[model samples]
Target: MRSRYLVLSVSAFLCFITLCNKSNAQVKLANLFTDDMVLQQQDNVPIWGWDKAGSYIAVSTTWDKKIYHTVTDASGRFMVKIATPVAGGPFKVTVSDGKPLTLNDVLIGEVWVCAGQSNMEIPMKGYKSQPILNSNEAILNSSNPNIRLFTVPRGSKTTLQQDVKQSHWLAASPESVAKFSATGYYFGRLLSKMLNVPIGLISCNYAGSSIQAWMDPETLKAFPEIKTPAPADSIKEVSRTPTTLYNAMLQPIIGFGIKGTIWYQGESNYDNPAQYDSLFVTFVKILRTKWGMGDFPFYYAQIAPYDYAQLPPYNKGGKYNSAFLRDVQRLDEDKIPNTGMAVLMDIGEQATIHPPRKQQAGERLAYLALGKTYNFKGFGYQSPAYDSFTAKGNSAVIKFKNAANGLTSFLKEINTFEIAGPDKHFYPAKAQITGGSVTVTSDMVKEPVAVRYAFKDFVVGDLFGTDGLPVSSFRTDDWDYNVQ
Candidate 1:
């Protein structure tokens, strides 16, 4: 009797183990493929996931009614490139691995990746004491079904991750939009209304993260100084460890198709302005390579003016020229192809790092994407930039590109102009608009060798393009800050 009982119990246990194994053998999709997701229109969008080893997986789209097939590798990974239709979708995508899994309410539209630090992460509700311009009204009006939002979970990892742990697509409503990235939401909203199509914005941001935090390990190898451990700070709380955020955040969704990325970073990298241009350019290159897209549109916002002079003593005396970082950002646009910058010379706050006029910044970024990427007609996307400067007897006459429609000055007199002599001592100068250019003269510097406009830690410029875009901050000289 005892032996019979023992044999029966052992048989039942083995049967239970078999059932569990069978249940766990189903296929899984990437986190980005949840319901209400948006795929880039008119591109080869990649659908990838994991399944039982050696299993055959098939994907079918309701729009085309065509099935694409691939087999899982020995390690259980499967990927297939499927062509997406143009600019419209309320479609369904079904993937089968012996069982069917369907994603409904999917969209095919223009998709943008919105990335950066605190400024980009700031929501419609704003942060701390800095409020977004007209946030209450924007939130109340945020009931758009055509716009989709996704926020990646925050984490830091020592190694690269294949997938996000948890994420979901949320449609824009008052409740959802209030917590969403205001800059990203406004940018997408503008694109949707102008293009008359769906828009997808993937908000991937980590506040107070340096550029190194978003770069892959291979990219960080090129900048050995960034790899070294930062000196300890007891008061400040954030981590400056290299490649942690990239491993945790960026790697997971790299191959997901995106029209481009609009960035609002650089505040954390302000202390080390010297390496910003090369680092930023290399970061863009690495992303393009990983995404398998060659030179797609890369639009970014210049760091808004902030009084970093008030940064704590532990921050290396806290005396940094944030203007230098802004200059580097503009230099990136000149050096990198298919790149543009949104100037924020008039939108920043003097006492706060977070700027309230994120709406304008977001709209300007959208203008770049709309005019340059989609070729929208009559869109004056490029801001006025310093084109040519010739020294006269005691003044410099500067010409500008993208000022053909003419310029506008807010105040009675144009401000923030500076002139420097051979000694490199910059002093305030008188500036006046003449036709499509500005003439600057300084009584302090008689033989002015260089000109700088809005080149301070905090400044508000009056010069604007006829299209209503602010002129970019600029410095004509390459002199180091400590040269004098």
Candidate 2:
């Protein structure tokens, strides 16, 4: 009996040793650690992967050449932090437990996660329905190896994934730029030219995705109105389903260090525009927490003017619901720190939702990042926003911020100003720009209690700052203006 027990114990020990050998032989790195990738500079970026439990892994970067080490946990997951140099690299990252896995042609530079709906997902090659403006010229000039691109595969899973199914980082060329996000590519190219550093863009966007679809489930639970149907057992269209894209596309790259994020979405959430203030604030908070990056720059484009109300041709008669959605996005500037909105009111088309002038939108976003986050001086990134109003007897004096250089009318006359009294019936108000403030008065309104500018679904308002940025739509009241 004792001899039989010894033989059984030896067999069990051998099996355990075999299992250990299998685990050790299969050291794998996260898919994010790929060739032609970019890492955030001047930060301790995490280099992580799987190895045998209790096995020590060594990590080194070609830029620094200092070796760092860490051991795998009981779950066979290992992560090591490596310091990156300043914004410049065509370096390599090497990790080893028993065998070395190397990521080559890596860049250490500014990396921004460009994420949102179809507007952001639109490629430079132009959509089947909407052709991008100046795309041919842009594509021809886009053969820069320093500008890298990585587009997250569009799909959804109910559960969070440690790695994306399949993806690759490609150096920007005419062919690659045609397939990548137009806004993302333009933004990166601008940064690369201005900052003189390699720019890496992680395009993690999907068409027709709502803000709820990109938010965490736990965060959405607090706002029941904004949350979608709960994640199910099987995968569906994650872009449309709440929390699915966050689980699949964003969750895998949550810890991957990035400089900031630029978003272009809101059409999908226009139905619940009122709740967007809270939902968007909550979304930014959740993203900051998940990324463990404190208040990183978050810039977004205001929803462009679209005929969502299906107004008749040559008709500006609509509920102006999309205008309200733009207002909600603007409110984030006051509610959250390190946030900005790119006003695309003038660039949008009345007939189509996808505007052709995407370069202007992208350049506007880059300007915000440069001026606000990177401390670029003398850079005009903001438009003249409505600051305050003073009722002066018959007329209301509307002051504006960012109008230090004064405001100008692109048209022969200033347009889209409406004034109302206690009864709240707005009528066209004659507006005249005097210095930095506009004096608005109407023969119809005796005592103007409220003022609105460009507060319609589609309006070609001529108000602009001397810097040439258009004025965003604004109203000084919180009235429930939904006409649905």
Candidate 3:
């Protein structure tokens, strides 16, 4: 009986040991630090994860053969820093405790995290009206071994996630770039060309994601008015809050530094133009603060024209108009230091949400970064913007900045213009240019109370500066849409 009891006790102890081992296995690091990872170049790379308590961790890379080491805290969290490399390569990282885990095919290159709405998320393959042949040729013939891509799976959570479910890095090829963001690819291509370095693009964008969805929950709590819940009680409700995208997509990769950010957003927030000025400023502040990147170059695209709701009051129903949103964007450019706006007021599709002209958009953003940040000369970084306006009887004369030599109409003839009176009645007006100023007049309004250009959702305006860049929408009135 004593021998049988000893045998039972031994079996029980073995079973308990196996259960403990299984639990520890479940508490592993995130997938982001797996094999074939590409750390950002010229930045402090953060390698972190969960492990057994008090477990000593060591990391090694080709850039520094001297293995960096750290020990897991009480919470099973560990972090180690590694210097960035200018060029990319096939590297390796090994972590050890009792057993060794080796991550292979690691690369050191430039990594950019792309985030925003559907336009930024639009894949190259399904873009309508784009020349499929051109994209196909570019993809198939791609030989840039240094260019790599890692796509963060789309997800929304009220709480921050330690790691994404699954992800892997892929070398840019025809098959890969086809499904990648066109804007991101073009931007990466330009950077790779100019810098002559390896580039890694990290895409963490969602279709139709609002500014509110990208913000932090605490940030949203600060603005009670914006915290409205979606019917399903999902994270989508968080979209109404500012900086929601930053909380989700950006927060995870905050310390994973890159060259800079190229933004293509703002369509979703156009309806609430009044709040955008403050919200945009707040967003920039949050990103810069969280990332510890002091006022790095943030280049964004101005919202392009789209079809307006053709109701009695055209600007209602959360629809987008040009001047209001563009003004908000301009405010960011003027107020935010080390920031640039890529004006695409002339390149947008009138009827489509996802404009197929992504190459131009990407190039324009690259132009700003090269000229302003990289100190490249001879690059036109800005499009002409309305500087000031003067009233002359029934007409208003408008002057512009960044006109280069002078302003010219891209249209065969001058097109989009409107004039309003004290009664707030607006009518189509004719426009003519002299030097860098545009003169707007209409026969119906003998005395103009205000003047507006490209105020509607879609305008056939073709005005451009001497540099051939489009003129952004402008307005001189502040009348409420419903009151009008």
Give lDDT tens digits, candidate 2, residues 15-81. 4444445443657888777899988889988877887788766666778656666668898898777
Candidate 3 versus the native: TM-score? 0.85
lDDT of 2: 0.82
Cα distance off (Å), candidate 3, residue 14: 32
- Candidate 3 structure quality by residue, lDDT tens digits, 5-59: 1112334434434444433333355667766666777676677777887765655
Q: Which candidate is the best by lDDT?
A: 1
lDDT of each residue in 1-484, candidate 1, tens digit only:
3211111233443443344354446779989889999999999888899988877666778887766666788889988888899988799998777567899999999899999998999999988777999999999999998999999878777666888878899888999899889999999999999988888999999888888888887788888776533334121323356777787788888989889999999999887778887889999988888888899889999998877877764242222778888888877888888988999988988888999888998999999998888889785888898888889989899999888887778555887898989988888899988868998998898897999988878788678987879888888888876532
At residue 305, candidate 2 shows an lDDT of: 80
Regions of candidate 3 where Cα sits further than 4 Å from its true position:
1-29, 34-36, 127-134, 228-248, 308-323, 421-423, 445-449, 482-484
TM-score of each: 0.92, 0.91, 0.85
Clashes of each: 0, 0, 14
| Model 3 global lDDT (CA atoms, 0 to 1) | 0.71
Which regions of candidate 1 deviate over 4 angstroms? 1-24, 228-239, 314-319
